[model samples]
Target: MADPPPAPWIGSVAPESVLWPGVRGTQQAAEWHNAPIDFWFLPKYAHLPHPVVPDENIGGMLTQLSATLRQRLDAVPPTPPPRRTRPGERQDNSRLKTYRTRLRPNTQQMEALRKTAGIVRWTYNRAVEYLKAHPNASFHDVREHSVTEDGLPLMNLSWVTPVLYSIREQAFFDAHTALRNGLADVRAGEIPNFELKFRKKRALFSSFRIRTRDWDGGCLKIPNFSLGPGQHQTKIQTGIDVPSLEHDGACIKQENGSWFLLWQKDMGEEKMRVPAARGPEMCAIDPGVRTFATIYDPLRGTAAKFGDGDHKRLFRLDTHLDELISGSTQASAKKKCYRMRRAANRLRARIRHLVDELHWKLRSYLKQSFDTVLLPKFNAHQMSRRGQRRIGRKTVRAMMTWAHGRFRSRLNEAMEVV
Candidate 1:
């Protein structure tokens, strides 16, 4: 029977089947992580050979391709650089939220991210130096910064290091490529500045690894990277719509410090078709100090208020703890304050969860009572300013910390017609 189907190729076999001889059974069966490998077509490189094409040929094509891209960008208009805004003048909540997220990264990850940032900065400076020296020549005519390997120009870098072989390398290359293109545009008088100043700030870890087959067409194996020893591995497969230099997935940390690769499959927007309808029904949301949210339903002619007394109590306790922390001289007292602070954070998370549930209930009521919902575009910052004048500044700031914008966004997303 064709030599028993060549001992049932484990890699090719369905994850559900019983483990065959010489095949290792994974900790989990048939997860999204252990799915089959697939390829996506890159629109920009559709006419060119596949990524799996021979290294020498790929290098030659990429060199010519880079030149063509540089020329095209030179013809296009460059975008104007962003202007620096005063600290108080920046009103965008999205920007503020992004700033808040930056505070979440640990020390180690933050350090790594900073190193990459430095690399980018160095690359930009070098590129500028090159451009300045050769003012007469076009950027398209400029050669790449070459590195030597074994006394020869390192054209084929894929074999040298796994990091070089990764999608992260591609992303680094693409970022520099785009910057070069932008510079070219500026040089041609297509737009304003030849340089865009990137602000130094914390950035998320964008690149991660996943297990895949070897470069020499060998059996499937893990790539050379440090994962915790004896850790169960999960492979996640994701789809790509737009061309990307990074894998569309993540390696999630488990309780035992093990990581499972979470592949982001189907990276495309779900086409949402909303049926034609009249204007949304009027629903007044009053966010106040007494209550978290007060819903005035016009359809039912009723007002419902949701309060978080427990959260308020926790907040008060935290305030007392803070006072104790400030006054205390002993180390143990400071430790006690830290514990209280941790408890306060947990309580805050719970309060947020409760708020989300309340919003969900309000949405359900709206769906049943009316065809649509109408809410006043409440500017939390403006409201906070008003509150500061009326109430105390500390009280207004506390209210702002509750994230009224986030609450409003959640409501909009839940109630929006799609």
Candidate 2:
């Protein structure tokens, strides 16, 4: 069939600027100029049918939306976007995508969320303490007796509305799970120093994961918070107290100043029946220390290589922390501890960002560009051993510290598309 002609734009604005769903001030939608209005929702919206409900019911509503709305939406341009990879950018075949958006919160709403986090941290700690005291406590017993009348008085805490919020249930499970795992680890001789960890108020991130059922488009409907009116495209019937979320899969991160919600929507080949044969064959994937990875196909005479990250700053930070700890008095020990933790956090963040980026890019590039990725499994523990005195200290440390397990998992996720 012959397709409709492309929609006309007024000046720099899109044809249906006011009504277009994919055009917005978001990370993903910022590239709307690259795709036609008809192809606007192609990547994310490909799963959905034409109508949310019956056509007749929505027909009257559609008529109300300007007369040229359907024409504007349906018309397609000749060329499609993302034809080839950019010089440096990596692509993946993974269907899961996360959408993040800022939240507009007043003072009260922010505090309410913080309180929820505090209660969760407290609950987790209390569970650990109970398990420690009673060595023979079963998982069921720990779950039951973790939050009780005689202990932490979690039931008496009037502020914690456990019934209204679904995160409360997850928090309860997290506490129970932590104790169970800690005990099991102790039994396995994992924690040699009798070091069952405890959760502290300063240590927890002030964000809670929502159940999939509770999450609607852009907004999370928790018990206390409400998704108020005067917002954009809020089809969900929620109050002002609810917080608007972006995507699912990603967690709700409470930053230094305010809360930012990161969400992800998983895309699948089974659901979409997307063909992998559209791309070339990739024979081997080598996760290298020199570069991040090396992909080669002898038959095609083509190769793809990913670069490694420089973690010198992390080692420098660790050295600084060690220096601060050694030759220090008891009075300055607490200060040194704080310094060490802060440095460790920065190091962790750096590693996490680099590794995650590498994983995402490599996985995506392989998925879109290759039909199949053949990977030979290597034992990370064996490869990551500390070198003998023959090697330099830096080289030995590098071997000891590389996170090969995480790298493997990322490769696995990216290749699981088919």
> Model 2, stretches more than 4 Å misplaced?
1-110, 126-156, 162-165, 180-197, 204-209, 212-217, 222-280, 308-336, 387-393, 396-404, 416-418
Please report, in order, the local distance difference test score of every candidate based on alpha carbons: 0.39, 0.50
- Candidate 1 least-lDDT 10 residues: 41-50
Identify the leading candidate in terms of lDDT: 2
Error of 1 at 359 (Å): 5.1
lDDT string, candidate 2, 209-255, tens digits = 55554555535444444432324323232223234433323355664
Q: lDDT by residue for model 1 over 12-87, one digit each (tens)?
A: 3355223221125533232111113221100010111111323676456545644554454345445546543322
Q: Each model's TM-score, in the order given?
A: 0.39, 0.52
